[model samples]
Target: MIQNPFARFLTGFVVAAAAAVLPVAAQQAASKPDFHQWAATPPMGWNSWDCYGPTVTEAEVKANADYMARNLKSSGWEYVVVDIRWYVGNDTAHGYNEKDPAWNIDAYGRFVPAPNRFPSAAGGQGFKPLADYLHVRGLKFGIHIMRGVPVVAVQRRLPILGSKATAADIYSKEGQAGWLRDMYTVVAGRPGAQEYYNSLFQLYASWGVDFVKVDDLSSPYHKPEVEMIRRAIDRSGRRIVLSTSPGETPVAEARHVAAHANMWRTVGDFWDSWEQLKEHFEVCNRWAPYIGVGAFPDADMLPLGRLGIRAERGDDRMTRFTRDEQYTLMSLWSIFRSPLMFGGDLPSNDAFTLSLLTNKDVLAVNQRSTHNRQLFREHNLIAWTADDPATGDKFLALFNAQDQELAPASEAAWASSIITRQTPGQSQPVDVDISGATTLYLNVRDGGDDIAWDHADWLRPTLSNGTQTVPLSTLPWKTATAGWGQVTAGKSVSGADLQVGGQRSDDGIGTHSNSMITYALPAGFTRFRATAGLDAAGAAQNTGGTLQFLVFTQNPFRPMPADSVRIPVTLAQLGLRGPCTVRDLWTGQTTSGVAGEFAPYVRRHGARLYRISTARK
Candidate 1:
């Protein structure tokens, strides 16, 4: 059974704090270090675990890095982090092979990159070459490591660098991390323990690493090891952002973690599931007080787009979340100021997936907002608020927690119970009335039954003083159609066309030969279009055996027209008095014109994305 994160944290924090006592001056100095200065804003990047798992390779990392540099770098997406077990040579797609293990270590008992997987690390060269390559491309590199000294170091009794005591002298005979089998905790204040951690960061700094995500450290709240790691990073003469992981990190240790690390996981490994996303609302709310510059409570990675392709936990396929849920995930993470890490195969991202990453307006809320708080929650309906630091503009987010579609009547009832700012903690029933409002925004979950936007049902809002009903149908929304690629000849292809299914001969690097499609969009188009098909029948089943519609302006797989489309609808039709700029949500480009209709060509199972914006002069 999973233990309660808070209870476990409180218990561990008390015990660890009591056991690790240092000089009063030293403890105060350690706590006062300016760790938050490294990450002034929540870091946005891509990580490997959600897609490739233990089987990720140097080439794959470079491919993702190239993608980020080319497409996402301009938007402040920087870090390219390799997750756990990079030092294990025998690690495969499924999981680690412990019985026939191959360990990579230096003479000083520090784990090094497996030379087989990272050829640059061969002959004593660690990740220096890879880090250099990333730096040249204007990207930051990161690596994952577990807490404590390697068990092999202890067993081999290697001498700790710069210390007379050996690894065995510092290793604790009791309390190995429960999940990882290769390490043993180092006893705090041991003669060689500090030197051991120092040497580890020294090596990392030599390699030009910008981030270090230490796992198995937060849940048990190993105070001593955390301090040791912090001290090592400080002494390395480099600025490395520290991230603690494998959480539901105890809420009780918020301040402590913030002082020691840049970002800490507030939940366990998140996946493409609605249940997990729902649970984050409460967890984020509980940890909201601890968020600030450099100290972010991570919501884990965004498991959007194509994930688990040859990953350890599951099979290769697209994510299981619906388009609506994906939007909700992005909205919640941004408003709460959680670190945004994309956890899908970057090379295989669809246009819609790329749009989700490139949204500048949404990303601003995450990168520049302040005073984030959960304004109110009523049963399945939840609301959040954040203020833009520069302009003091308030952004509000409403969430529908229920799985099924909420009826108009029920929406009004729920909206009525939302007590406004004045009536804090008390609900006074009021009817929602959004009459004569110049601009109305509707947060609708679905496109009406057909492609038409005018037929959507409205959601009523309950305010402190009055109530307002907003028509969802009148709001600008997205519409899409999706289905599975038909199986052919014992195989599966992405489009309606079916062909021979057997695998093709490998192209030397373990990939099968396959056909590719490329297309461009027409000018003055409002509809977003995309096509999703499986590479193989087996991979399709691993991905829920269905096609998902996602909207994007630029075609993800091919070049598309860059010309802007003039939507013909007038500002009056959209409840606006002045001129409005129609923005393409996928490309983050704006086209100024009267709102009109433009039907863009869409391939079967494709998607389209668009939104309207108006500036008051």
Candidate 2:
């Protein structure tokens, strides 16, 4: 009975087919070469990008690894990944010197750890020494690499190892990525392309690397290169986990990605912001059907705790997310079963942040859960449900996406309406009724170009009976200052600075501009549709702005008014029946109830996790 159109479509074919074919698929998946042998569960680890960016030094990597070994290793956190441009000798905390990178390469054509940055990698030892150091402490080592053959190798015309062809012979001129200029893609069928990949993995194996996060290969999904990497890893006699990055990876390529890479990113470089976090709910849902065993739809790194100490984008500071939002982020990532790669400076973690990372009961959901899906999403309210395969416990996560706080208020005085809907030639406003209903839903549709600058279509309808006005700029829309570069590009750019009304300001950027507003409905209505068009003077600028509204409603099942309330669970909600025990995962407290609700207060932008277990009669 999910109201969302996409959810209803998914329920029909995807869910039904999954139930019928999963057992066999699970069995065959286990036998696959890139299955759980490398990552039995979603890889739990620490990545350095959020803190140090591309300039993380040996000391920083070691400090984080040491902290993990001493503190977090026992709780399943292991990999110490040094991310991006590590070979660039002149790299700084701000960004990398991509053009004049001082890459460490040997006579053939594989990148090695820079000795000046990683002192232990001196004397031609490569990362073997550093990997050995981490291995001794019961940890693993990882490094980031851009997909394709190094451009320098092609310039030098280095011979491909174990092959007659040179790097130039196998490299494609049209295969270079737009962002990184150091590499060019390998033509899959060209002679020595597979051999070049084999040599690269062989060198990485020699360095004892346990993980390789390959970037620029996922957003467009370089299938040929992925297959080459997979083949190379198999031939290298190493069990390295291959993680694809900088994504919104095409969900249609799920089978190819699953067969090759251990994990694939579902979003691009996740940071600490509510706008990015809210965007993830949709991305994760699209990729949720693909998660299993070793093949994880990575939600990128967890940008928690203290971040941007020396990051590429933004100044040094603690995460901008509120405490409630942090909890919500963690809960969503856990229930979705995305790989947990903490992106903060591990050595600088405070006790509260550490508690969020080390929660075993909550971690169990990420490590062991099945049939994970978005149960319902109404306006700013979202819910996800999953089941523990070992035990028949059910886990439910509810999220409130609005920026405003949810509080008790009188429903009788409230009225709601559809503010305005504009298309190329039409604009209309209509009234809605919510007198007896407990939920309200808002659906925003975008008919503009689907380029990086244009925002994606977002729908956030919630059950409600009261209303509050919210400012357009105050909503969690991505905004940027004038001088801000394209570091966090794409739909992340907020259209707030553009013209708002139908009139254009003398700002010299645009012509006609459009904006959205939220209004209250009258009473006793369920749904409405709206359309809008955007026009900008410049080809690259966005002409539309986003707006948000708030509503207050009591939990219909529980009918209680407090920060916390217990609502009874039924067979319909959990897909189970009879008496059940509700245990708060965070508080470690239990309440005996008959397949009913458990009480826990969810913070603003935060979440509460519970283990609902049926009682054996």
Candidate 3:
């Protein structure tokens, strides 16, 4: 309801008047595309790729646009992008079809929306109607494109708009994308190369395109075509925000990439997997310093809510990430100043997904916070900090990368698991001291992604008190619970021989993730040991079943603190002083005190974002 469109209109009028009176060079200089102004904050919106893949229908796009306007537009989520292969009318599920693909293009070597797929383009209208449809609702339209001329265009040697040369004059057969045959590389500085790019952007500007994601141009650091696209956007005289795509984009080219595009991907095709989420913790930190130079490091789409309804990866279902992991994804991306393009089908979004997208205070950090960086990454506990530009308060984010409910939430765990998702399905050594403990709890839980088919095993289990040793399975377990089938003693969850990595074990226990088994230990038991791994039966499914292990002296099934993962640190540890007020934005709690050590807790895979400001007496 705010006057954002009005402000933009007013700014345009002022700029136009100023340009009229200025010299040509000055006006041109002022008109150059400085992308920072286009997306002052990280861009947020929805993309079709995750939910509908290359086959997103116009009706579906409209439904999502309607949802965003009705629910999320006021939060500054405006750009609705059609991701990848919109021109391929015959595209099928799980993958793009290269055989006799129904391609759509104009006479001038430019790809257009397929008329059969995009019904509005039945009479050469091509996305203009769809773009206009969004514009009227106070939303912006965007589209995805590969960074070269269509192969059919190059084969036919189609004419280049606004230039004497044709598509063949500017293309190369080398260095083409392995996955798709849609495009051939357009050589840098070749005749009509710039013109071909210029014509594309000019056509897009005419269609009211406000953003474009140019793919396959960043991972190998295709500097030439990237610069040409940057020039083309600037030359079009429209403020279309340029974003580069599909990265693990060489961190070496960080400087040049930031200067040219509004946002570049830091990692590639992030799905709702704990492995991907675990890796991004390191990737985000490395790219933090390069965030604010007129651009951002895109952490790719939020693979939250419902997904894979006729898409590339999974069957139609809700996101694979656990609820707490969903929070972790949002917290990391926001605090790192990465663009958030929600990848779910919007109309299908449940209330929880809607809540994730609409939190104002969290979105503010992505938009306006400064000096964002990793505070620490000690063991599996990681923290990130950023500064509020307006209030000069510090924003702190604490995360527990451990899959199980580890501490500072419970400082008394017999063993706290860490770094298991790194090389999943492999056995990890577990050794914990249990001297004087009457009972021992063995636990396994999902690593914040999903619990489907996560098989856990305790191989070669033993208890040792120096000279004497005992097989853990020999001891009668007091209680056993598994997320799936019955927990088994000295066998697989299905009561088969204890096996992992195709090897059998004579002594162990097997269970599924989100499971726990407890045992009453005899007096003088000094230590417990096991080699833990995913049973081969579960690993063979390749369902990305990740699990974490834990050893606790007390019963872990009891209710933990509502805020479960609290880490204690002094004000000095956060570089602060006396009389500081800390606010948990997610919890909506304000703690006012002359603080020493700050102990903030969140449940498993949950994050606590603290806003610290000086308190007045």
Decide which is better by lDDT, 1 or 3.
Answer: 3
Give each model's whole-structure lDDT: 0.63, 0.67, 0.80
CA shift at 496, candidate 3, in angstroms?
30
Q: For candidate 1, write residues 408-519 as lDDT tens digits.
A: 4233211222111122211122232333332222211211111111111111221121233222222332321111111122122222122112233111011111111112
If both were scored by TM-score, which would come out higher, candidate 1 or candidate 3? 3
Q: Summing lDDT over every window of 10 consecutive residues in candidate 1, give the lowest-scoring window.
A: 449-458
lDDT of 1 at 23: 58
In model 3, where is the ten-residue run with the lowest total lDDT?
A: 1-10
lDDT of 1 at 46: 91
Q: Runs in model 3 with CA error above 4 Å?
A: 1-28, 404-564
User: Cα RMSDs of all predictions?
Assistant: 18.1, 11.1, 10.2
Looking at model 3, residue 372 earns an lDDT score of 84
Error of 3 at 67 (Å): 0.4
Which should have the higher TM-score, number 2 or number 3?
Answer: 2
Better of 1 and 2 by lDDT: 2
Which tens-of-lDDT digit does each residue in 1-617 have in candidate 3? 11123223333432443565666855765656556688867888899999998899899999999999999999989999998999888998776788889888899988889887789977888899999999999999999999899999988989999899999899998878755668999998888999999999999998889999998887667899989998999889888998997776787887677667888987656777675687789889888877763478898999988898988766688898898899899999999989999999999989998988888988888888877889888766788988886876888888877654433325445444542334643667888888888998888866654224466898888889998999987888989877655688877875557777667888889897667788999888899888888776556432335667788886554444344667766777667886788887776788887478787666666677878887654
